[model samples]
Target: MKLANLSIAAILAASSFAIAQDAAPVDTDGDGMMSPEEVMAAFPDVNEDVFTAADTDGDGMLSMEEFAAAQEDGLIPAEEM
Candidate 1:
């Protein structure tokens, strides 16, 4: 019983870490779009030039579609497992 509990705890801890590493829903403002500021907050390594390229339409913000495209184009890193 003790071993089973320990195993469960370990799984839970690992899952929590994975969740923390995942990049998703960076649209923290509920605006359905991502601003350079929001992206930077979520991914500190992403600089302005990278973000401008990701913006695609030069709209100053990334719509969900643009964000997806950026991911597909390899401009954005895949979510860390």
Candidate 2:
């Protein structure tokens, strides 16, 4: 019984670690956190207003969809840093 419990605990711990690793990396833009600026910078030309728009979730922060939309809009460039 003890062995089974230990095995279960180990599996859970390993699963958590894997989940963390799969998560997105920290903000590289140095804006203190990952924001539209970082993603937009990676791609450029992303509409700044979309990121600033309050209607999208009303959180005042850009969601992954919004960021992706900006990319599709050509606001986020693929070159020029």
Candidate 3:
């Protein structure tokens, strides 16, 4: 049981790391947030409509947390990130 639990924990850690990597590229300015231009540049297929929707707070920029939430909510495609 212990071995199985350890394996599960490792898998979870790796998954989290992958998700973070996937999210990293969106912040082109490296300000730890994503602006509309950054998102557009990173994911060219993304448009203003999707970007506007993802900016839940109506702010012009998206925090990492906002981006992650948008991903979880399916507002942004993971493969495009």
| TM per candidate | 0.64, 0.35, 0.67
Cα-based lDDT at residue 29, candidate 3:
63
Top-TM-score structure, candidate number: 3
| Clash count per candidate | 0, 8, 0
Residue lDDT tens for model 3, 20-55: 677787776678778888888877777899888889
Model 1, 1-81: lDDT tens digits are: 999999999998886554333434577786767899888777777789989999989999987767766767887766521
How do the residues 1-81 of candidate 2 rate in per-residue lDDT, one tens digit apiece? 999999999998886554333223323643333376554555454455745651256665544444444445665442335
lDDT of 2: 0.50
Q: Which lDDT value does model 1 have at 74?
A: 80
Please report, as a residue range, the 10-residue window in candidate 3 with the lowest summed lDDT. 15-24
Cα deviation at 70, candidate 3, in Å, is 1.3
Model 2 lDDT-worst window of ten: 18-27
